[model samples]
Target: MESGNTITIACAASKRTSLHGLDNIAAEGSEGYDNLINLVEDLHSMNVINSEESKELTNSIISKLKEEFNKDLDDSIIKIENWGAHIVRTINQDSWRLERLGSLLQGQGIIIMDWAMKFLPQRFREKQTD
Candidate 1:
């Protein structure tokens, strides 16, 4: 029937959209992870953080990001009857966690980068003034 065909088409479209959404999230997370790594490495280079501490911080962040990404992907899958209702329910349940994880990464990246920038420059200035 035409209605059945239309329903199938809509479902397919929704699925594609969902996949694209997940891809977007993955890309954003990847960028955040990269920024975190760069910030830590820069701190190490500036002697602001030692090698062991930098290594541990980097590994912990990478692991947490991977875990969160997998969890978010799993959570976003549509498995129930009503597509709209299911999406709403998933968003209500999971969006806060996802947003929090993202904000944590983003916020930390900004904070660390700011501190590293200032700390290194201030140290250089102190040396010159000495």
Candidate 2:
């Protein structure tokens, strides 16, 4: 296994996270992360966890997310998948045109995709810039 560190979810939250360069986090994973895991374990011992578990439960969830990401990363269309690919894929799969989508992002300044858009009432998608 690679050197995996225990990245504390608390330290990663919006309130606690460094606002500077928030766009770029985690360039790559490193080794010698057992120490990090120990640190996270200490956090858990302090009683910090979700309703579903007593401990914060890091490794298993991290592993599962990594597995899902590996599949996406290996995909031919978007190796290092990003927003642009996501836009293209949605259009290709839904038989949507770029112009129609542009109206959502450019005109509205926000693009709500897939399931998240379903909950949005028409009022949420009202008149936009030209």
Candidate 3:
């Protein structure tokens, strides 16, 4: 499969995995915010939604959860860096895929790397270079 298709498939698979977690988390009262964040991050990483869409969805969910629990919940914005980290984590988890993707990108590796590096956590970036 082409690299772009591979990425899409990987991202879709990741989303499916996360959605299962989300289903479980959603059952708990007021304790699922973190999982919600992960869902949003995964959605954004998958390109299934844009930043604005993520933000809107987050706010909507938070509102619903608050109404259900009749308690205040912290509003969250879509963290692009977290999304970046999620993508990196996904890639790192499969070394063979990373190699294939790198080869697929070819001359564009530097540009993609530069963009990804900017948003990755400092600790992750440090570990990568070590």
Instruction: Give lDDT for model 3.
Output: 0.59
Query: What lDDT score goes with residue 52 in model 2?
Result: 42
C-alpha lDDT values of all predictions: 0.65, 0.49, 0.59
Residue lDDT tens for model 2, 25-112: 3322222233455556666677675434623456655675578557744773454457678788877866655556656754465354
Residue 104 CA displacement from its true place in model 2, Å: 49
Ranking by TM-score: 1, 3, 2
In Å, residue 124's CA in model 1 sits off its true spot by: 60
**Once all C-alphas are superposed, what RMSD does model 1 give against the true structure?**
25.2
In terms of lDDT, which candidate is stronger, 2 or 3?
Answer: 3
Which is the winner by lDDT between candidate 1 and candidate 2?
1
Better lDDT candidate (1, 3): 1
Candidate 3: misplaced stretches above 4 Å? 1-27, 71-130
- The pairs that clash in candidate 1 are none
lDDT of 2: 0.49
